[model samples]
Target: MYKAKIFVNYKPSVLDPKATVIQQTLTRLGQTNVDSVMVGKYFELVLQGNEAAVNEQVAKLCSEMLANVNMETYRYTLEEVEA
Candidate 1:
């Protein structure tokens, strides 16, 4: 069995509104060092097959559907699991 952990995040240039909310909350709590916060997505996929094939298929799926190429970037790590 093969498992994939995928992480998707916004690009550096993107402005995340969640950052403002977090900063405001921190300031209310007397913490000023807080700078920014960005939201991201994490996905785990499992496939029953060879490692190489699963990796390729998952990568393709991420590129084609899971991640938005224009403003988001994604990366994945694969591991073998014994059942």
Candidate 2:
């Protein structure tokens, strides 16, 4: 078995309105140390198949469906799991 951990985050140039709102709220509450906030997504997947095959499929999913390749970036790492 293999376990895959995926992380998806917004690109630097892509501005997140929600994060901006959060920062503004914090500043109004007398907290101004935060420079900015970025939102991201995390996913954990368990696969019961060959490592190479699963890695290929997971890469495709990240590039095509899981992440927005235009304004977002993603990476995944896989590790062997003993049963």
- Candidate lDDT scores, in order, read 0.87, 0.91
Q: Candidate 2 — what's its lDDT?
A: 0.91
Clashing pairs in 1: none
Each candidate: RMSD to true structure?
A: 1.6, 1.5
Candidate 1 residue-wise lDDT, 1-83, digit = tens: 98899999888887767766877888999997777666889999988888888988998999899999788899999999886
TM-score of each: 0.84, 0.84
Cα deviation of 29, candidate 2, in Å: 2.4
Q: Which candidate is the best by TM-score?
A: 2
Q: What is the lDDT of residue 29 in candidate 1?
A: 97
Question: Model 2, which residues run further than 4 Å from truth?
Answer: none
